[model samples]
Target chain A: MNATQSLRQDVPEQGGRRPGGHGAAAPRPRPGADRDSAYWWEAVGEGRFLVQYCADCRTPRFPAREVCAVCLSLEWEWREGTGTGTVDGWTVTRRTFHPAFEAPYTVLRVALDDGPALYCWGCLVGADPDGLRRGRPVEAVFTDVGPDPADGGPTGGGAFTRVVDWRLRE
Target chain B: MAGTGLSGAAALAGVGATPLSRDSGVSTTALACRAILAALDDAGLGVGDVDGIATHRVGDSSPPWVVGPALGITDPAWHLDQFGGGGVSHAVIGQAALAVAAGVADVVVCYRAINARSEFRMGGQGRAPAGAFDLQYQAPYGLLAPVQHYAVPARAHMQAYGTTHEHLGAIAVRQRAHAAANPRALKRDPITLDDYLASPWISEPFRLLDCCLETDGACALVATSAERARDLRRPPVDIAAAAWAGGHSTYSPPAPGGLGDDLTTSSAARLAPRLYAMAGLGPDDVDVAELYDCFTWTVVVQLEDYGFCRKGEGGPFAASEALGIGGELPVNTHGGFLSEGYVHGINHVAEAVGQLRGDAGPRQVDGAEVALSTGQPGHILAGTSALLLTAGR
Candidate 1:
């Protein structure tokens, strides 16, 4: 067995950040919302994860590029994911770069089972650094990270910027 | 076609550096100009002799356009203003070789000067500009610094190779030992694996000891045609081979399509064979080397990528006594960016030149004839590069 496989656990595990109490700030840097990538963020707010596929060559890519490398086409479309993925790699951040995050959180790179593997970054709800292994099955769990909508105006839990997290599947 | 006539076409005639410190207390421009003058003087040339200039900038250092006139060279025949950081190090040197080989100009000077500690600390947690599409994907996830970006691949290497923290600590301890011999090294005291493990974790699997120093300094070198160099003062360190190869992009893990099956493989994987072929030599032929050490894992990765060991063997290879002065491959003889100062990777070039010239004093590799210097890899836009230098007539 490979080194990663040797560390694998057969039991299902929980991963992804739990919602903080009412007044917690977003614990990460905000993505740049420009013309090319606004649609991806919009999908995240609606509790969906999206990846870009080239309209001409039918090639899928992440973070949205201007032109398709294969067919040189400038056209593309956003496709919803299948929500199933495998943990291809991960890192447990013991130190927080942002104030919103507490110490010791896990970031996993999940290759979505959507046709070609579309790699997305997110927290694994309850996984520890030692417990993670490659090839672990996971499914998406979008979490509300924006300001609260109950306050009505630009207060807590805004609807525009929810984050896509993940949980280990049995 | 590897190396072809490019071998022995240009020579590094001189190398210079400002005293490394946490704060230089001077402007980056002044530091850059001072190092350039020192290099030119070491080459037994004046500002007028510098007909070509190549340097990299990140809105911090003085560009060649600005540095040239300040050095009294009003107009240079060749100039290159490379972008990004250590990943572009040897590629900038390769630019100087290209200029000299093509006869665009002679007496090309390559330099990198930054007030990295005082003005722009590399270790800070500020977000990078959303210039590349990959940053758009990574920034929102709190992957803020080079340490954070590299952690993804470092962890993959660990999982694939069984590389432990002790292995990473070995690299730190060995480089620190080399640094202790060199006076210019910033952090010279020895560190045990226990001390390394105890150092605070900047990122997962990466402790404070794993990261390189944030230094305020400048390093510069003069390159000219081999014929011209023979007439100069110091022994010419012939630019035997300089090759810049295409590598993976900045697209996050489960890399973009062209990166192939290995997330743990570095650009040096493809770059080293090409580099050695161009130099008409192999890994075993190198007498000394200066691999870029932006992080300790980088040293481990490059050790494998440069053909020093097998892919999964980097950690164990580093943990052995093989990387020290009397060992198989004496790496980072001037301590490396981890312990030496961070002048991007130009200090690697400077150290290589010093080794080739038999001027490294106590830390010099014995019979160090053929030297290798490599740049950081995996910059989607900048690519990566390596250089082979040899003692010349």
Candidate 2:
């Protein structure tokens, strides 16, 4: 699952088609940002996945936490992820409530070996929808989801300008 | 139940509901007031007689204070405003029962009113407030809405227990049959297993038929001392026990391994024993079940959690006729949130009250002496709650 050999082959090229669009145009809804989670988002923007690791207990928490559940230790560090994980479970949303999230996209619950089993959004590029199975290996991929370059320059219609998504490991 | 102090202490004296619909064409406030008034009337009480109130809301419903004023009760001796979807279903009523039992307040009315379908559908792209850890981690991945959130566990349950969509479909079909007899049900058309299987998938493991209705309506119940209820207009359903508790700490900065141990189980596992202990009963004593059916998978999970069946056996249990109206337990006799409507879980309480009083016309469980009603499966922050209603003492 290491992308070093592939020279970051898992990462999408700067200007490619963003996911969840069915040739329809809609602004994506961004994650609600606040002081606690801004650092996590910033790391994602830089193409690095970070999990809050408790210094005292050696436990890693996701969604960012102030105090460790196991140790109640306030001391923690943002550990860089290996960008590799296993699919604990997944769902292909055939219909959705958000217009920006086009239907028929698979959402995988990835159990990061080093982190929590969240990372709710998933990606399985070039794989059949039926191919999705628990325990399948996957690696993280970052995509710049901005105005399509072909739309005569930034119409500025999308959620996060860039997001850290995932893809199945070859 | 030696310590079942509240047993026969309070009773559900009245149950009332507005018409279930996709659109009520009225403000949630108006709907809440109307339901409250109707319940008061059913209880043979008026605005002046009401001394306490309680309600649960999901942002789409009006709060107790607003509804109290509209119903001509400006000042109440006891009142509670709870949050969360199905978790508060019976917890609010339990709180009210405690109030009445402790002599803090009497003549308490518990209600839940929502215009969910018409205004701010729960499935829509409504982001949680900032700093909510689960939303921050999940929203970026487009894991919005309860359907998607719930599907993850349903998938895990299937993978581990080999639970199939057919197992879940049977629940939908059976509940729809119950709804067919309920005139107030929004979707009363009887559906077959094939119809359930044929429904399009909203989220995998959850087809369109597996989801609860996006309902616009309100349901309310009146609670007072069993002594007071004897003189009321209707027969009383004694509040044998009402219990609520947290579980597994799944989504709250979840434990290291994610969702802790088993995904198929819920907080009900921890709650069922306590609830029955308070009522001095067990699963076998329950004549009817009104388990929350926010999604069919939830019902399946809860059946196992509450000791109706062994853990991995929920799929097969759901597939059997054991949950039908004439079957052993007769779950969700009013069709549940799946087919009847989603007034949170208050409707489940209403149905239990009806069955216990022998007021449920076609769907009533014969000689139902004990009914078990559940709130949402306890996983999310809302956790879980339940009540055991028995025929009056």
Q: lDDT: which candidate is best?
A: 2
Best by DockQ: 2
CAPRI docking class of candidate 2: acceptable
Residue-level lDDT tens digits of model 2 in B213-274: 99999988999998999999998889998888775534455554334445567888878888
DockQ of all candidate complexes: 0.33, 0.38
Q: Please give the C-alpha DockQ score of model 2.
A: 0.38
Q: How far off is residue B137 in model 2, in Å?
A: 1.9
What's the true lDDT of residue B157 in model 2? 93
Q: Candidate 1's residue-wise lDDT over A97-153, tens digit each? A: 665454555677777787454677776663445777888999877665544323233
Interface RMSD in Å per candidate, to 1 decimal? 4.1, 4.1
- The lDDT values for all models are 0.77, 0.79
